[model samples]
Target: MINRAEGAYLGAVRAFQNPMLDLLHKRHAPLVVSVLSACFTAERPNVSVADAHTQIGDALDQLRAAGYDESLPIGTSRDLCRQWADAGWLMRQVVDDVEVYRLSAHAVDALDVAGRAGGARARVSQSRVRTMLDAVERLAQDADPDALVRMARLDAEIRRLQQELDRIQRTGAVEEVDDEQLLEEAENLLHLARELPADFARVAESIKSMQRDVVTALRQDERPTGEVLREYLERAQHVMEATSEGRAFAGALRLIGDPQRLDGLSNQLDVVLRHRFTGRLAPQQRTELREIGHRIEQGLDLVFTTQREASYVITAQVRNHDPLRDRQVDDLLRDVMTGLQTWMPESRRGQSVDPLRRLPVAEVDHLRQTAGDLRPAQPPAPLEDRDDAVVDVTSDEARAWGGPHYAELDRHLVTLADGRSIVDVAVAFNAAPEALRRPVDLLGLLELADNQGMEETDELAFVDAVRPDGTRRRLAFGGVTTRMKEAVDE
Candidate 1:
């Protein structure tokens, strides 16, 4: 018999090596691969047959224009889709009288691999080293039970860490990285993030497969209910506890659900994107990151929902086949009585009288008094005050209040010229009419930064201004610049 490890390996290989993949590798099947990629690139769960045909048509047109003279009619594209479905690379379903096609789990894996093979190179980061070290430590701890030995190893690790820190402090060294390198690292992080969702999709498929197996077993098996239930539980337990994928997925689920970790990751990415070494992300890149984040969250949700659905199915099946539920309480009680009678002697099977009935009434009263005396005393109740007091309900005298300070900042920013330091502009604004003589504080300047006309830059400036009270305040402000008129004209 093939062992479970061998079976799993073979199953994975079979999943990836579908006939459609083989066909796509053929010399004349380049267009087929392109069509599949175009259809699946949207990361959607499914596409309608008509939509797929249109996409394939576009792909074929592009291919034909590139010096390929193969005929690719809509009908041929449909036939190829059917072949893919037959090869288990796609699943076809009828929805609302229209046929739709979805990439199977295997197809998704294959496409992901193909895309990555042609994509940019991966970059290694500090997190990789930390993860590796953590994994190695965990393995060591699992392999060795001796606390002293572990402590010795930990001491050595601490010394090495201290030595590294000392070296850094002594050298006062800094590592400089180029913008291109940082951008590459950011791309790598995003690539890793995308893979997390794909892994979740695979796990969700596995869970669905497990659900189907359980249903089939429950429906087809003729064994005793307890025996069948035991088998099912064993299988479920093995999947959850013994499998590597299950453990890794469970860990990922926990990490994703942690609010602190998610916040940390978000902050880290924002810092990287906004850092002086990296610069701001393009609008399209930001959108892509948001989409990937959403997909990851959705994938995690899918895993949870799939598991819940599987649990519900198992529960329903178990209830339907439950032997305990089939036996009434009365029947169970009768059986117990029959067993008791079978074990007892015929003379000793008479109805027994209550022993307490034979006790004297005076003794019962004495016992009740003793039990009452033995009970613990209750604590005293809290005191309640009955005093009342009157209070004034009049509003305070109205005082002159300035409107939102930021509104003045916005008006001042719009009136200023572009490419001027923030301090020079602030000084000019203060000298202008309707400008606040109190001078805009840092908080007010930050509020200006949020205005459509103002943006923070690396430029800096200082200006001295006087308050309405004639006190001189030296202000340092100027990272903001403006191009409001240019934007509006555009």
Candidate 2:
């Protein structure tokens, strides 16, 4: 027979691995996956069977438009819904005499995975580094109860900052990142932003589960009320405090609620969006990001509500039994006994104890000396006299290299006949008055092909062009037709 440990291990592994993943990967299941993704990935609380069916049909249509010819019958969609309900990916309930589906915990986890997998790959960025540093500082302060431990961490951070400053001074300045690097970092930020909501949702679900377990235990357990309350309180504290995931979840909730952090995150995202190297996001990505943000906010609110409800329930239960009050009395007696044990002898009681005597004096002195030695030295003063001289340029000289004035070219091109080839326009431009034929004016003519109303035709023509330097250049002009308005008779 298999051992209990082996069985437990297998069970844990099974719980971690979603069977729906295999079903999603099966052939002919792409449409089903898309339907589930669209329906569950959204922030809606529930979807009726009719609505889900309609959504599936719409998804199938989209798939067909995207060149997938496989036909999905209505029966197949219904069967898929039934399968998901059976597999625990969806919970079905009758609402207003109509069946509706809400995503099960497994479904939510599956969707979270799908979202991250489909999103842009995350990259390390300066903002993320700063956030990490802030988290480390906060954790050090919160997790370490000893004052000396906190002092040591703070000292180390200070030294690290000093070293960074020294490195920057030696290097003159930080180098600018190239476009490729910026794009990678932006994509990474987007990935993390998308995942944030999903993470919050999972945390909220865990809290809800804990709440449910507490309620169930209170209702079903036959133990003494005080003992049960104590057990529940201990478990709740352990889940919300002792565990790393719990701590992280709590930290994330606090960060989410922090206005300054929210503003900083918003500013960072705005910068990423406005970056020259960051191209336009796909429609789906934009939608996903917006949905993620909305869902995260909603999930956080729900978590707070659940917590309040749990607290209310616990308070009511404790009040009914008065166990906590009795327990407090017991704790008081225990504390009194512990204090008696710690009471000094009559001879020693008269002597005053120094708080400093608690610490290792030699170690403290060594730390002080080491900290003094690690302090950064002051920089040398600059030279009194410098050979560099500043030069000023006249306005005309500055304007000379400004390159290309395109207003005249734009006005002339916009008034041209609808079907005129770019070659014909070029000839007309060349034959125009000298005042309109300035190199800067012709520069605007080249930009017409890129204009909004300009449509390229199959024909191509070679044209002679004059550069801003007055040099002759051969240019290939793709025949383009401009949309010109017809004059209406008065």
Model 1 agreement with the true structure over 160-264: per-residue lDDT tens digits: 999878988999885677776666656655666656645666676677778787766665555665776677677766665565656757776676879898887
Clashes of each: 0, 1
The CA lDDT at 213 in model 2 is 69
**For each candidate, what TM-score against the reference?**
0.49, 0.46
lDDT (CA) per prediction: 0.63, 0.62
| Candidate 2: pairs in clash | 123-188
User: What TM-score does candidate 1 reach?
Assistant: 0.49
Best by TM-score: 1
- Model 2: residue 335 alpha-carbon error in angstroms: 55
Model 2, poorest ten-residue lDDT window? 481-490
Q: What local lDDT score does residue 336 receive in model 1, on the 0 to 100 scale?
A: 80
Work out how many backbone clashes candidate 2 has. 1
What tens-digit string does per-residue lDDT give for candidate 2 at 112-190? Answer: 5665666654556665676689779797689879988888888998999999899899998976778776655555555
* Alpha-carbon runs more than 4 Å astray in model 1: 1-29, 41-43, 46-78, 91-101, 121-138, 156-191, 224-230, 276-292, 309-490
